[model samples]
Target chain A: SQQGEEDPQALSIQEGENATMNCSYKTSINNLQWYRQNSGRGLVHLILIRSNEREKHSGRLRVTLDTSKKSSSLLITASRAADTASYFCATEGETSGSRLTFGEGTQLTVNP
Target chain B: EPEVTQTPSHQVTQMGQEVILRCVPISNHLYFYWYRQILGQKVEFLVSFYNNEISEKSEIFDDQFSVERPDGSNFTLKIRSTKLEDSAMYFCASNRLARGYEQYFGPGTRLTVT
Candidate 1:
């Protein structure tokens, strides 16, 4: 299993606070993607950072990747109640084409 | 603002019965994929299709499971004999191309096998 593992399985924060989740993998990857799932709905693509890239940002979401450590982190700033959901980090292995192995995910709860 | 779409949002069937989950990927997308989540478990990749052929498949995709693009606009996943363990949320996703960065996912079909 080339899947990554996310740390801090669960998190809780107040509306205006920040939430940070970390993921660590064992193999070399071509790219890593972050997705958000709201309750029972499908996953929404949040961000993607390539192996060569160190940091990327999209609106309130910031992602950082460290190839040396084979780890990545997702930071959500000023979270809202609506941001409560599961966040997963998926890795595209160097040999896999369009195939993604997803982590267990981090359950986030933001209270307003 | 195109998105992937799936039919039969929820289906309940008895064990050993066959079920087909349908999905219409974003038009113009060249790569399609199927994934499933077993309730609280993490999402797992089942297979990926491209250029009218299967590009890759995981160990989970076995003889009991198959995928087809029976028409120009529809992609289907067929479970020949669904077991109680098959109960899960199946998601369909597609990207503009294999090199495309982001993948758009469908709302998913919830399968409940009794």
Candidate 2:
């Protein structure tokens, strides 16, 4: 299926704390991307990490990819109430063309 | 700064009826795609279009589904017959290249089939 599976289906944290979410996929991928969706709104792209890259960072977001384990993790440092949203991990398979197989996503709630 | 845009933010249709969802991608982007997310489910890809033709499509994009780029600016997805299960949030996305880059997504159209 090449579907990405995310763990910790939901997480709640206080502002100024850190929250982490993990995802595991079944097949080889070209790249993995993280996206955030606020309630029923559109998805906002967060970060992209290639298979060859082990880690990357953007602002308060940090992403790590381990091809050997076919797993990835996203960490949001110093979380804010505004950061409350559903975080999804999507993977572009090596042979899947432009299609992105997404995980079920982790619902995050950051309390102020 | 260009982003994807979709029309009819919300649509309600009866089962067996046809519906067409519209989208206008980023001006310079060449690759366009349609994806959907059922309530509380994962986002699933339906089709990918490039150069005005379908380059790739998932099994979910069955005979009931069709895509077209009738004009230079608009891309459309038509469902021959809506099923109750077809109700979902449909998102349109686009990218400048075919791969390796993030695809910009639209606000999405919520289709409610009754």
Candidate 3:
């Protein structure tokens, strides 16, 4: 299974602080994406970093991918209470045809 | 902004019964997919559909699970027989040909098999 695995199962941070979550996968990938799920609902796509790209940013969210290490990290800067949600990292396998495999997500809580 | 949409947000059925989850992907999207997540578990890929046929499927998409695009707009996943373990949140997703790697997911249907 070329599943991505997220580290730090849970985290709690005060509003305005930064929260970082890491993900590691076993195989090469075409692209890595970050998603946010609120209250166990459907996932909302946040950012996508292609294999050639090392870093990508959208608003307060930044994602860094290191293919050499088969790892990726998502950083939420100046997190507000609205940023509190489970963050997931999904990978589109290099050999697979556009199938996104998700990892166990990191539950983030922002205290206001 | 168009996104994937699914019908029957929640379903409760008895074990061994048949249930079909319906989805209508974004109008212009071509690729479609079905995925499920058991509670507290990672989201798992079930199947991917393209050109009116299945292109890829995971181990979890067994004989009991099947997907179909009956027309140009609707995509469906049918469970021939629901097992107690099949209870999970099922998500439908789709993407356009230009952006095949970036999928937009539906709200999902929560299946509770008794």
Candidate 4:
């Protein structure tokens, strides 16, 4: 299994607070992506960080990657109720192709 | 913005029956993939198709499973013999040829095998 493992399987935060989720994988990867899924819906791509890059940002989402540690973290700043969703970290294997291996995911809940 | 679309958001079938899940990937995209989530489990990759051939597949994509792009617009996953354990939410995804890293997923088909 090339899948990653996300820490803090679940998280809850106030609307104005920040929420952080971490993922650790065992294999080398070309790129890591973060996705959000609202209840029963398809995943929405949030951000992508390449192995050559350490960090990337999109809107209020901040993603940091540490290839040496084989770990990545996603931070949602000033989270809103709408930010409550299941977050997954997917990795593109170093070999080739667009296939992705996904983590167990972190279920986040932001209270308004 | 274009996105992948799946048909029959929900399908119910009995064990031993065959099921076909359909998807229409974003037009102009060159790569297509199938993934499934068994309720609370992690998303598992099934297979990937490119250039009209299977580019890659996981162990889960065994003899019971097969994929085809029968037409120019539709991609399909066929389960030869559905089992109760086959119940899952199947997602279809596509990525542009120029950007293979970012994939767009369809809403998914909730397959219920009883």
Tens-digit per-residue lDDT, B1-114, candidate 4: 898999889999999999999999999998999999999998988999998899889889999999999999999999999999999999999998623369889999999999
**Top of the candidates by lDDT:** 2
* Residue A111 lDDT, candidate 2, scale 0-100: 94
Ranking by DockQ: 2, 1, 4, 3
The list of candidate 4 runs beyond 4 A from truth reads B98-100
For model 2, the local distance difference test gives 0.94
Q: Which residues of candidate 1, in runs, are more than 4 Å off?
A: none
Q: Residues A19-103, candidate 4: write the lDDT tens digits.
A: 9999999888989999999988899999889999999989999999999999999999999999999999999878756788899
Interface RMSD of 2: 0.7
TM-score order, best first, reads 2, 1, 3, 4
**Regarding DockQ, does 3 or 4 come out ahead?**
4
Please provide, for model 3 over B1-114, each residue's C-alpha lDDT reduced to its tens digit, 9 standing for 90 to 100.
898889899999999999999999999988999999999888999999999889999999999999999988999999999999999999999988723368889999999999
Q: In angstroms, how far off is A78's CA in candidate 2?
A: 0.5
Clashes of each: 0, 0, 0, 0
lDDT by residue (A2-77, candidate 3, tens digit) is 5789989999999999999999999989999899999868889999899999999999999999999999999999
